[model samples]
Target chain A: MTSPPAVRLTALTRRFGEVEAVRGLDLTVDRGEIVAFLGPNGAGKTTTLDCVLGLSQPTSGAVEVLGLPPREAVARGLVAAVMQTGGLLKDLTVGETVRYVGSLFGHADRSSAVLEEAGIADLAGRRVGLCSGGEQQRLRFAIALLSDPALLLLDEPTTGMDVEGRRAFWAAIRRDAARGRTILFATHYLEEADQHADRIVLISHGRVVADGTGAEVRALAGGRSVRATVPGLDETLLGRLRALPTVDRVEARGEQVHVHAGDSDLVARHLLTATDAHDVEITSRNLEDAFLSLTQEAR
Target chain B: MSTPTHPADAYDPAGRTPPRWGGFNRTLLGLELRRMLRNRRTIVFTILLPAGLFLSFGSTGQASDRVGSGNVAAYIMVSMGLYGAALTAAASGAMVAMERSLGWSRQLRLTPLHPAAYVVTKTLVALAIGAIAIVAVNVTGLLQGRPDMPAGTWVACAAVTLVSTLTFAALGVFAGYLVPGENVMQILGPGLALLSFLGGVFIPLDVGSTIWHIAVLTPMYGVAEVARAPLTHELPWYAVVNAVGWLLAFVAGAAWQMSRDTARV
Candidate 1:
């Protein structure tokens, strides 16, 4: 028999008293896929990741990792996680911390290799308290690599990193993923999800709003935004633009007007010829637009 | 669906070999011991307090009065040793509070290390700390030459005192899971002092008195009595019951709290 997917959640729900943190969430991640759980704050990204790590049980439903229960999978060294914060002891040096975690797996010698891969080998002697947030995140990354797990779960792993640090981190992660490791990370940054993930699963308020390739999810919004600079803008002109066929929404800011529509050509012609509008530009929707429209629609 | 009642029922569709309980980790124990040693306040409270108290009080009254096989000074020495061991063990066990606050416990839950293994490691650390405290207080008594006891009795008292501190270690673990990190020591410090009084470790109580009846019921009462048995030649059956009974209670409470601790809010 073949192995199951890397992770599977069926109708997973977690409630904290009156608040439902995760509600009826269902997702499946296959082997070697770099999947991103993209959502805004309080969208239940961390809650879902916690369930996958076996740190919390779902109030209802089931979770499976590597064709086994989450805890069982973790106990077999098949799954590891890099939490968002506070896993490092401030007093221990980076080297000691990595060595300690490695010893848990009986692989203390792998500490140096993982430290080198995480790009924190030179900071080995520095106390974790002294390390910068980005450096600490790298240290956490090093510890997560100690087990050489088949699946890696990262929850907002780059929240405190600079642009350069994020780039280096992703580069290292990409290299690791190339070795056939499955990675599922949760983050709110749309660009990070679009640029790195093979598949993006957009979640809002504990439910998935969209799930597909970056381009396909963008296409789900299915419209172009026509932007132009128009002088003497008034309510009548705004009304006319909103009344255009196939137009979804119209917005006016100073001398600029934005009209979202399925028919960009008609909106563009109406703006340039009918009104005194210049510098007209029409472009397909980006991931952020799709995220906003899709999440809003879910609401 | 109900939770799995047996380990065999855990999901294993791919038929991967199940991971066994790999005994306690030594590397973690070594690092934890090192961290405990580095904490100056723990050393001061666990070692110096009991040793200092013994030096001042053990020589105060009836210098040559003998009870059983030792003098009054020997009696006070045994009491002080038990006090220090209990304090040290409890403090060492309570280190879990800091580990929890740092999210280190949650981090460990993701690994192959078993939760029972972690608890055992912490208990071992407590025992180590307890041993240190017992040795420090006994050594101070030896160097002072104020306490008189046979070599065999001295070793026996120290061993019993060190071993009995396990009860307090479990107590510390229970309290660690019950309270926040910063508040653990603050609460347990005074709480232990009151227990010491009730146990008759600080002030001797008249036998068959009203307070004696109540003191025997406190958790530390059995520990104090059992540690001083070699000197007092007293090994009452109820003291053993009290010690073993409280140990089981605290262990159960700690296990319950720890299982809840992992259920993240």
Candidate 2:
């Protein structure tokens, strides 16, 4: 039989006072896959990550990392994480911090190697306090690599990085992923989710609204909301337009009829030639718009 | 070119090999102690400050003045040593609070360091610094204070002061987890001073006075009384009970706070 997924959460629920931070989250991360956990603010992304790392206990249900409990997996150095903020000692130099964490996993000399791998070799002597936000993140990444962890979790790891720094960070991550390590990164950056992730899991209101390949999720949030000035708008006309394979929804508003279509090109052509539609405008959906629509659709 | 050998391959993939399993993590403990020693504040509090207190109080006491069988000068030195050692040990342990606020402790929680191991290591390291303070004060007394005391009395007082560090270290760890920010030590400094005074370490309260009755109940009182017992040669049964009682309380508090802090993580 095949082993269980690298990470699993079954009906996981967590509450903070009156707020339900994570509600019945069921997720599985397989080995050797780069998955992006995407969500807007307070969408339970961090909460779920916290549970997977055993930093927070689930209020109900179960969570397992690498076929073991999160704590157990961590103890074996099978799981490692680079959190968004504040898990470092400001007093220690980058090399010292890396050395200290490496030692915790019984890998004393691995720190320098990992620092080089994470592209922070020049920052060895710089104290963590003196490092810039991006530099500190790189240090965190270096420390994460010291464990030779099988499953890596990056929670908004690129939050404070500049455009160039983010690119470099993802490059290092891709290099690691090429070696058959599992990676699950939480990000609000739609471009990163689209470009770097093999699969995208979109969350809204503490529940996953979409989970599929980047292209597939993009399709869920696909469809242009096109509006135009059309004379003699009626239910028969709306029904006819909706009947088109490219159009999912068509509605009449005053003198104008709005059409939501999978392929606006087909809808636009049909509208202009078959019906008296004017002032036709088509706007392509950016990833941001697609993300927002997907989240809103779930609500 | 040969492929690089991964570190995980050094251990069994199942991670049950005794050689690779993380028990107490000695490297982590070594780094923690190394950093603590390099910290200037610990140096001042555990070494320099206590010696200064010893020279100031221990050298000036009248040689003729006596408490029980020991000279008043030796008494003053012992008391100052207790005050310094306890404070330093407690402060050393509570330094974790500042690191916690900076998110270092939470970072540690993600590591393989066991909770029990964390507690034991912290307590021991705190005591180590406390030992430095106790030794510094006693050596000052030996060289500069009135030398009329017996060597046995000297050793006993030093022993008591050194052992009492465990109590303060546990208390420090409790304080570290209880308080939220960098101000834990700043607040604890004054708090410890007040407890020291109330426990009759700085000034002896009259034996029959109401303050003396209440002093014995204070946390510091037991530690002070037990440390001075070697000088007085009048080790009271109640004093041992009091010290044990407070130590138990501090230890329980430290462990409870530790578990509560990490239970969610």
Candidate 3:
């Protein structure tokens, strides 16, 4: 039989006095699936992650991981997390921090392999306070691996990393995912989610507004836009194009008309034959535009 | 969607599933112990401060002065020993406040380390620091003209001093919860010193005096009186009740604050 999903959140709602941080959030992740939660800041992404990690109790709802409560999974070494920052001992050296966490999880002897995997073996003697932000995040990744956990949760793990450092960090995470570890990360960076996550869940206003693959999420905001140079553009012809089944929206700028076409072929044929239209140009919105369009629509 | 009802509730942090972690992690214990010792401030408070007080107050012409049944040196030694032990223990325990403020405690919560184990480890490490202070003062007393006493008196005084340090260890945690990271130790240091003086840990007070009456109500009064029992050879009834009372009070206060803080996260 297949194993239970790595995580399940059912109608999760969290309210802090007057503010509802998360409202009716439902999500599920099968084992070994690499999922990324994408949202703008204050979109309830952190609140959702906090609920999943059992760090904060929901005002009304539940979060389960690996067929157990978040706390129980956490206690069984089945769950591990690498938070953005501020959860590590500043006074302890890299090696000391890693070793201390290992001992806490009954893995008192896992420093060398995990440290190498996290790419921090050389900085073992450096105190966490002395390490750069990127270096500290790498050390945190090493500590997260001490449990040999089946699932890993990262919250904006590369908030301070430069381009090259972020590439290396994700490379390490990719290797872990290759080993069949279920991975979930929350990030506001659109490119990171598009490139790294297999499945993207876009949250806004404490709710999932879009859930799909990167291509699908892009498709939600993009379609073929046909700009046609139609001579003698009259009100009657423009009205005809606007009502066509293939044309989602139509706009006219002087004699040139722009039509957002769900099917460019149909709109092109209509414009060419049904009217004295010619010189049609087609373009598609990039992911950047799609992201803006989708997020703006949610608001 | 319903919640997962797994059997792993056995690990519910209340000692229900103690076997998983064996109720303690030795590696963590060793690391905490080593880190506490490496701190220069801990060494100063646990060793230098107490030893200095012992030399300055327990020696000189007063060594022959009698209080109750023992000489002045024995009385002052027990009092100074109690101060050092309590200082070391409480100071160590209060470090948790800084850790929490730094978010280190939140990080640990994500691990399989039992929550109760965190408290146990802090208390254990505090006791370890308190032990060093207790030993250092006793040795200072032995070398620096302490009251000559029977073997049982020395052993009992040491035992009381060691055990009574728990009160301060718990009190430190309570204080830690109430204060911020930068001021937890700073505030507790001067506060505990004042409490020591008022509670008669620094000097003997007449039985029926107003200050002594007020002293009996302070936390130090109870533990100090108990530690000095072997030296004075009189275990006052009020002293025993006070020791147990403050121990329970501090423990309850710390546990309550810790639960609230952790939950708030």
- Reference interface contacts recovered per candidate: 0.43, 0.44, 0.46
TM-score per prediction, in order, is 0.87, 0.90, 0.93
Which model, 1 or 2, shows the larger lDDT? 1
Candidate 2 lDDT tens digits, B163-260: 99788888887898878676678877889889988988877778869998888888898989899897787766777888999999998998788677
Residue A60, model 2: lDDT of 96
Worst 10 residues of 2 chain B by lDDT: B1-10
What is each predicted model's overall lDDT from 0 to 1?
0.85, 0.81, 0.83
TM-score of predicted structure 2 = 0.90
Q: Please, what are the lDDT tens digits per residue for candidate 3 over residues B1-265?
A: 3234432322232332212553368878988998888888889999999999989987677787776666788788878888999998888778887788788988988887777788788888988888889889889988876666666888898888999999998898889889867578888899999999988988777989989889989999999989888878788889899999999999899889888888788
Q: Write the per-residue lDDT of candidate 1 for residues B123-230, one digit (tens) a residue.
A: 788888888888898889889988898999999999989889988888888898778675798888889989999988987878899999998889989988899999
TM-score of 3: 0.93
Candidate 1 chain A least-lDDT 10 residues: A100-109
Model 2, runs deviating above 4 Å = A222-239, A251-258, A263-269, A272-284, B1-23, B64-70
User: Best candidate, TM-score-wise?
Assistant: 3
Output the number of the lDDT-best candidate.
1
Fraction of native contacts, model 3: 0.46
What's model 2's interface RMSD, roughly to a tenth of an angstrom? 5.8
Model 1 CA lDDT for position A211: 94
lDDT of 2 by residue, A1-299 (tens): 35457789999999988999888889988776899999998999999999998988899989998678888888878888999899998878898898887776654469779988888899998888999999999888888887778889999889889898899999988877777678999999898899999999999888988899877886678767778888997888888888888687777878788788898888889889988989998865666877898888867
Residue B152 miss distance in model 2 (angstroms)? 3.8
